[model samples]
Target: MIRFDQVSVCYDGTDRPVLRDVDLTVEEGELCLVVGRTGAGKSTLLGTINGLVPHFTGGTLAGRVTVDGRDTALHPPRELADVVGVVGQDPLAGFVTDTVEEELAYAMEQLAIPPDVMRKRVEETLDLLGLADLRHRALSELSGGQQQRVAIGSVLTAHPRVLVLDEPTSALDPTAAEEVLAAVTRLVHDLGVTVVLAEHRLERVVQYADRVVHLTGDGTVTDALPADAFRTASVAPPVVDLGRLAGWDPLPLSVRDARRAAVPLRKRLEGRPAPPARAGGAAAGPLLSARGVVVRYGDVVAVREVSLDLRAGEVTALMGRNGSGKSSLLWALHGAGPRQAGTVRFTDDGAAPGAAPAERAPAPLRGRPGRLLRGHRAEADVGRRRIGLVPQTPTDLLYLETVGAELAQARRESDGRPGLDPRGLLDRFAPGIPDGVHPRDLSEGQKLSLVLAIQLTSAPSVVLLDEPTRGLDYQAKQQLIRIIDDLAAEGRSVVISTHDVEFVAAGADRVVVMAEGDVVADGPTAGVIVASPSFAPQTAKILAPLPYLTVAQVADALAAAGSAR
Candidate 1:
């Protein structure tokens, strides 16, 4: 259904081709998954399918690309709208209407479909994506997961033969991601729709893909079955790593298969205790405290009476389903959003000895805080800023055109600090970003790194990151784990609001689960994540009594056991 014959793409002002000699084919009714590191041309490859690469993105295409035997060069995106439907990374960028029903129907209207058929298709698409209940809700009011489903429904309504999705489940919670992936699977199996999807979170979608398209970082592609492809692929899920560590004959792509093959490995780890929590030691004092915090939007309350403490030296993970008030609480603590009713206080440990307490003073029941929370200078005197926040949208903090300009600005804002160069920090967190590339041109992971480097220039005592691992590959995620660990080591508090369960297991010391605008469960990572099946990692699910959270931990335990014997 889709074919790329000697395809190569190169954007203006760049010498190297983003994609080079990529000859590939996708059979009818097949689901192909594209995996690669950040800025590895996965997006470029997906765009070529629907003719958005050279047409919309202003790139040069070397070879012919066709969908359903229709050459993309001859037909622009609008002309091929009937044959190809593309959904981008950010659904809000593509949304034109306000409400869910209108957004879904707008595509059909553009396609000029018959009114009767468009209406029937809209109903079926809503039912298929389980968005019927939210049909009347405004698109802006929906949760991230709901917005994702609506975006997919909008494209599905057009009844395109080929569906191209870029990071479809990156913003969704686990349950919602499963629902969306299941809908995509149904489209491939039940309706014979060809799907080409690119996602950084391989664990969530690898099981659903019929074939894997591995995009090596150096401008090449390898196509193979899921098991065969993962053997040498630079990026892979935890289950794949577990299978490799155990020396299984064929690497397991899904958790179920890995669990079945893990019988012997589980026996070896039978009596071993899980690795110690990264932040097992006790912290000195509360760096920041929130008392009876409440946040509301119009008539709806997002965060309700939530009281929590961030310790001086610990990594805390804020986890819950979609729309569980994680984002609201983060913003309130940072003093960027409406607090409604709350007292956010910074302790002396986080402040200077003579410095007055930085407080988010409560106003009326519907009023916001008097002043925004800035990092305590005392903390800055000790070689660290008081607080830094990276919002859910990283781009919101960026404005400069080139990466060099952004880094230079960050350095300048640091006021000629002794050892705070933005370029040096960028290398530590996310490397390989060119000086000339625009901030918007960087991949999601790369952009997060740039913003994180900018925020770290202040040397903040507390760091709050919302979904930092959204677009990071496994290697990039490992780098992030180290970065968070270093922050905790510096006696700084770190809090991350994310739905990536494996990331929580790997890095977080404490897990705080919120539901309905309240803190429901807060405890050590092992205790909290293992108790909930929905949030537990694959290793924890397979090795229940052993308390293991990752394959790396299991491998270490076995190696120690062998040496002792």
Candidate 2:
């Protein structure tokens, strides 16, 4: 249904083309998954589908892109709106109406569909995407996952032949992500609609793709089946790696297949003890404590009387379903969100040991509530800055024109602590980022690295991150894991609120599950993840009773067994 012939896209003042000599064809009803590293041409390639690349983005296109036999070169996005529906990484940006019902109907109104037809399609879309309960809810009140479903429904209501989604499940929990993907699968199988999806979390979507397109960072694309493509692809899901490690004849893409092939490997690890749990905050007293925390906005209570503790030199992961108050609790603990009936105490050595919670004054607000929630901050005393937070939206902390400018501004704002340099930190966190590149122009992973470097400039006692793995590729996520480990090694506390189960399995020292504004489960990572089927990682699910969270852990156990033998 979509074709790209000898396509090359070059932006203004850039020496290299983002996409070079690309030739691809996506057949009707087929789901094509595009995989690539950050800053690759995946987004650029998707934009070319509906003529948003050269037409709306002011880039130069050398070759032809056609959708449904209509040339994108001859048709702008508006002209092809009926044929292609594009949903970006951030659903909030694409929303045009305030309420879920209105947003879903906006596309039909644009297409001038008959009133009766529009009403019928809206109801069908609401039921299809499982958004019927949220139809009357305001768009702003919906959670990230709910907003994503609404965004997709808004386009599906127009009955487009092609759907292009970028990181559609990044913000969703495991269960919610499955629901959305299942809906898309039904459209492809039942309705014969075409889908082109790009996602960083391959473990969630790789098994469902009909074909995989691997985009090398050097402006080239290679299309192949899932197994062949992932064999040599730099980034792959955990199950693929496990298959490779076990020397399975054919690499398994899904958990069920992997488990079947793991019988022998499981026997090899039978008597070996599972990997030891990583030490957590209990070694030292709580560095930060939240007691009876309650956060409310108007009549809605995002967090209700939740008590938690963060110990020095520990990594804690806050996990739950969408709208479970994970983000609210993080913001409250950081002293940036409204705490209607709670006390947040920074128990560092600077505070009096015997001082009561009420005696300690709250930290002054550094920026506006919105800005602070996005990780932005004004200058403050280095010693007094006990907590640093990177919110769900990393861009809120970035406003400078270029990477160099943002780094220079951060250096200037620093308190001249010894061995603290933003430029050096950026190099360590995300290498190869050009100084002249615009902050907005950088990829999602790169933007996150920039903000993380900015937050680390303060060298606070505690670090809190919300959805840090939203758009990060496997390699980028590994680097982030190393950063988190290093922070704990240096006696700093770290807490991350995320729905990426694999990430939680790989890095988190402890897991805290929240639901309905209350802490439902809190314990070591292995116990917490293994108890719930929904939150368990692929490896744990595959080897149920084996207590292995990752392939690496299994490998370690095997190595220990070999050594003992």
Candidate 3:
């Protein structure tokens, strides 16, 4: 459907080409997933397909890009719109209309389709995307997931043969992300629409991808068959990780396939009893406490009577289905949202002369008493630099020229004392990216790591990360888990809001499950994961219930069992 020949794209502002010597092709009805560490030119490659790179962004193009035989340079975005539909990472930013129905119809109208045809297409799109109930709703009234669906529906309504979605589900929660991805998969599998997407959540979508396109920091592209691509690429899915361990030649993409591959190992186990819980150690006092918090947006109650305590030196997993109030709770605690009635206290259990709680005084005071121990807690005032946040949409934080400069800004502005080496810390945490390039140019995984480098630069005691591993491949996920583990070992309190149950089970010390603006379950990680009626434990854990939530944990358990036997 699209081909790039010796393509080198250099934007007007910068001297270096964002994508250099990139030669690639996408056949009709092919589903290709483009992945790289952040700033690695994945987005640029996609932009080139629809004439957004050199054309709309005012860049110099040295090579030819052909979409359905039409040269991208000769055809602008409008001209390509009939053949291609592009949905970017931020759905709200792309919205040009107020209502969902209007948004879906706007593209058709632009194409000059007749009124009857436009109406039929809009109706079909609404039904296909499950937007019938939301047809009359304003764009602003929709949640991030709904808005993303609308963005997709608007594009799909154009009935373009090729669909190029850039991080389509990055803003959505887990269930919503699955819905959007499933919809996309159907479009390719059933409808024969060529699909090319850049995403961070590899595990969820890798199963559906027919091919994987790997890009490096240097803007090099390589085509790999699904299995080969995942194995050699920067990251792969959890099933791939499991396949590697089990010595499967072609990695299984789905849990069902993984289970079949594991049958031999299961038979070898001969029904060994599952392992016991690891919550025997007494948990410490509250590192950060919240009591009777109530936060509402207009007439909608986001969080009601929610209370919890995060202990020192432990990682807490905040989990829920999409729009289940996980983000709202974090915002309320961070003071980003209004709290009708609540108090958050942060203090060291061993600290000397701890002061009484400052009632409704200021956010800084609440974080001050604990500042001496842990640099930041969510309750801290914005200016105090006590809490470091990695927002759901990481792009919101990226406006710097280089990754190094971005980290430097965080180090300079953070509450940490003088003499902190931002570069050294970034190297330690994010290590691989080139030093001089802009952060916006990196891949999804690299961008995530770069932001983490910035968020953790201050060495804050409490770090709040929303979906840190959502888009990462298996390798990147492992790397991020190790980083989080090290942070937890440093006595820093980390709260990760995510939908990856495996992440929560494997990495977190405790798990907090929220639904409908209330915490439904909270306890030791293993306990909460197993207890949740909505959460189905990973197959490895179900077959061999380990205290840990990762594949490494399962490996350890098996090794220990072999030793014991």
Candidate with maximal TM-score: 2
Choose the strongest candidate by lDDT.
2
Instruction: Put down candidate 2 lDDT per residue, 307-404, tens digits, no spaces.
Output: 88898888999999888888888877776566789777777787666432333433322333442222323324432256778877788778778899
Query: Which candidate, 1 or 2, has the higher lDDT?
Result: 2
Ordered list by TM-score, greatest first: 2, 1, 3
* Candidate 3, 1-565: lDDT as tens digits: 7888998877655656678898888889899999876556777888889988777667688889999999988988888889999987668778998999999999888899999999998888887767898798788866666787899899988888999998787656556667778878888988889999987667667878888898876767888778888777765656677678668766787777777677776665555544432222345666667888877777777787899887767888888766577777776665544677787666764322333233332233211222222244433433234445676667666766887677766665564664235566555545656678677666555667777776666566567888787446545565667777766766667899987765666677788888778888887776677665345445544344323345664566678787987
lDDT of 2: 0.83
How does each model score on TM-score? 0.93, 0.94, 0.84
Q: How does residue 171 of candidate 3 score in lDDT?
A: 57
Which parts of model 3 are misplaced by more than 4 Å? 10-20, 115-127, 130-138, 216-218, 269-282, 347-385, 395-405, 415-421, 432-448, 470-473, 530-548, 558-565
Q: Ranking by lDDT, best first?
A: 2, 1, 3
Residue by residue across 465-492, what tens digits does model 1's lDDT show?
8888877788777777887777777777
Distance from true location, Cα of 289 in model 3, Å: 1.6
Report the Cα lDDT for residue 375, model 2: 37
- Candidate 3 lDDT: 0.71
Clashing pairs in 2: none
